[model samples]
Target: MVSELCFSDLPAEAGQGWPRGGEMVGITLEVQALQSYSLDPHYAKGLHAWFLSQVEQTHPRLSAYLHDGESEKPFTLSRLMGPFREQGGRQVIPPNTPFQWSITGLNPEVVDWLWGWSQRLPAWLELRGSPLQIRGWKVLFPPRTYSQLLEQAPSSGSCSLSFVSPTSFRHRGHHLPLPVPKNLFHSYLRRWNDFSGLPIEVDLFLDWVDREVTIQRYRLESVKTTAGRQGSVTGFIGCIQLAASPRMPELLRQQVQALLQFAPYCGTGHKTTFGLGQTRLGWLAAERVSTPRASQEEQIAERIQELSTLFLSQRQRQGGSRAEKTAWLWATILARRESGESLEVIAKDLEMPYETVKTYAKLARRATKNYQSV
Candidate 1:
């Protein structure tokens, strides 16, 4: 089938529309079905059924991500579940080979923890369509806390303050996941634009999947001080960075959802050849959820009030990098839903997996609960 073919060989028509230096790159990723499943498009006509079937047989570690808008919520799959899992992913994916799905979105803060998550995963993600893993650039970079940790994280308070460079750190790099500094992401973006010779727009997506509604939300200040309820999706963890077009958060959102819908067919063993495919496609646009609004103080206050009642009594926690990120994600999900934005538009803007974004939203429902007593 055309979809199964390596993106390298496209129909003759795909070549006709190309302009000089206007090539599209296909990124391959591995997805683990959160439920039982198949990608044989014809196996089941019902979308939800087919999707549920497709997510079958995930590793024990990965859990179900779904939600219901009810008083006493029980996690269950919804309409966008399957398409977001098995159908919407593009040939595009992460920057390395031997693709890894240990974490969904890009969050500067989670760099250290996510890399650690990648290393510890027992089995590679198992998907149906194309199996691959992102290899090579899998190095973990320094977190916002790295410099501070270097000075104070020592158990014995000894600062072997030798030459403060990556080379010196590498000798002792066993515990230091790839020595990239927090500023590395910034520097990399500049380099990427220069290399592609294409004007790039970046939209960092922030999705919070916290179920419990608490006025006392966690923040950078509440690390150990925060309290989480039983069904609370555990302290509002989120995913960030959706590359798409500027001003179109909806398109990037769709791409994330579609990528997640097609999740059943992608996995670590899924492999691909590294090269840019012709045609600008979606990746050419470069988009992300707007940093303009939520980053503003008054908007943050507005989101807190507009959010579900479960969260009304609690704080979204923007006092620290970790907590502030959670706040942004919650705000974005809520904002998009109330506005009734189109996933296709969201995909066009973010230049990422649309289904993947939906997956994040599905997980968000389960997470953004407004539990009262907890």
Candidate 2:
């Protein structure tokens, strides 16, 4: 079943003194109905990993931030889902199946970055170590407005949301984490309030403190994530409809709706970069949605390819295959520095000597400066 929820451009800064275009705004782009040649239940996870590699290949800066978010995540990815035929209880997306995927940029720079790549539609997506041609793309541009969440609450004084993919949390608990209403909404609210580049009103803050949740209907099952050195992400997937308690203050209600509207774009919970925590609003207001397609810059794809090749060659020359291992590490350190992540955190995550990571960061900065100068 297909349902649509729309969010418009909401401007947010990339953090203190980050370089960007004058008008900072958050924009989300979705490429829907990508068809593959064969059935693969694991295609979504493969696509997720391929996306990370592609980002690292094209925009190391963004890749680094996604790896090390010192401030807020500049972007989030949702898991791709589509109808699949079952074989011996295994889910297999049929050959020539149409699947949809999206990327949400939290800052104008990210949005502009995505806009540049939109021109090269119907590109090859690597899945299961093979190049799969995405038949075509239906691009959603200009982003939709998320103002419906501000409408007056129903007389029942409640709202509901649906989860279409595996959604989980990182807070330590031995048992599988059930999606709690308050915690879920609070999670979205915190991200929205922290990264949306908007100030929260006093009432909204109070509502966050006072609100509650009731899970109406749900079907949850654990799903393992893509294979990687990071191991696997085991999370829950199902449909859940939650309602707010004590009614909700007007401002609080709107803020919640707004954030929920944007949640699908900025997926909730961990491993989003690897296609975990894909979510969406169950219902939406009746409004005519429209998108503006930006004209593609000429030779942009060629330019991205050129940059990717240069970086790959540089890394290969620096340490051969060994240097490739640290490509993500250096990018993480450099990206985190801009977002305010401390050296200690980066070292721990990369499992490297703190001083060594620092030195690499310095070298990475110098290299970037040199590249730009040339």
Model 2, span 157-198: residue lDDT tens? 344454545556766422234676555765566656655556
TM-score of 1: 0.18
Query: What's each prediction's TM-score?
Result: 0.18, 0.56
Model 2, C-alpha of 99: deviation from truth (Å): 3.1
TM-score of 2: 0.56
- Model 1: per-residue lDDT, tens digit, 222-325? 00000010000111111112232233344433433322221211111001000000011111111210111111222322443345333322555534444434
lDDT of each: 0.25, 0.50
Segments of candidate 1 deviating more than 4 angstroms = 1-301, 304-319, 370-374
- What is the lDDT for 246 in model 1? 30
